[model samples]
Target: MENQEVLQQILKELQSVNQRLDKLEAGQGELKDNQANIENKLDSVVEQTVDLKEFKTETNNKLDTVVEKIGAIEAVTKENLYDIAKLKLIK
Candidate 1:
């Protein structure tokens, strides 16, 4: 009778161990899935950052070109005004 009780205890212990191993496997799978999701999100964020930087550079270049054009226009306007004033004085 004692031997039978020992056998039952051993069986119960093995069942508990199997349950623990199953839970561990499930937990590992969940972790793997979460890690993959995090990596995908990280990649998307990195791409967006790169795009923003490129856009900023392009906008800055366009603004610089516009400023240069405005300076040239202002210079021409000044020269024209001077020429007109000199002509008026002579007349």
Candidate 2:
């Protein structure tokens, strides 16, 4: 009878140990999932930074073209005004 009681106690202790190990395994799985999510977010941020740089370069080129056109218009207007003044003087 004593041997049977001892065996029962040992069985209970083994079951408790098994339950704790199961909880630890679940926690490890959650940690791995969190790590994967963080890496994905980092990749997205890097892609956005590259896109912004390209847009800035394109905008600068367009601005330069507009400035050149304005300069040309100013030169033409000055010549036309000078011609009109000469015509008035002759009259």
Q: By lDDT, who's the top model here?
A: 1
> RMSD, model 2, all Cα superposed?
3.0
lDDT of 2 by residue, 2-80 (tens): 9999999999999999999999999999999999999999999999999999999999999999999999999999998
RMSD per prediction, one decimal? 1.6, 3.0
Question: What range of 10 consecutive residues in model 1 has the weakest lDDT sum?
Answer: 1-10
Regions more than 4 Å wrong, model 1: none
- Count the clashes in each prediction: 0, 0
Error of 1 at 82 (Å): 2.1
Instruction: Quote each prediction's TM-score.
Output: 0.84, 0.66
lDDT, candidates in the order shown: 1.00, 0.93
Off by over 4 Å in 2: 1-18
Error of 1 at 17 (Å): 1.9
Q: In model 1, what lDDT does residue 49 have?
A: 100
- Can you write out model 1's per-residue Cα lDDT over 1-91, one digit (the tens) per residue? 9999999999999999999999999999999999999999999999999999999999999999999999999999999999999999999
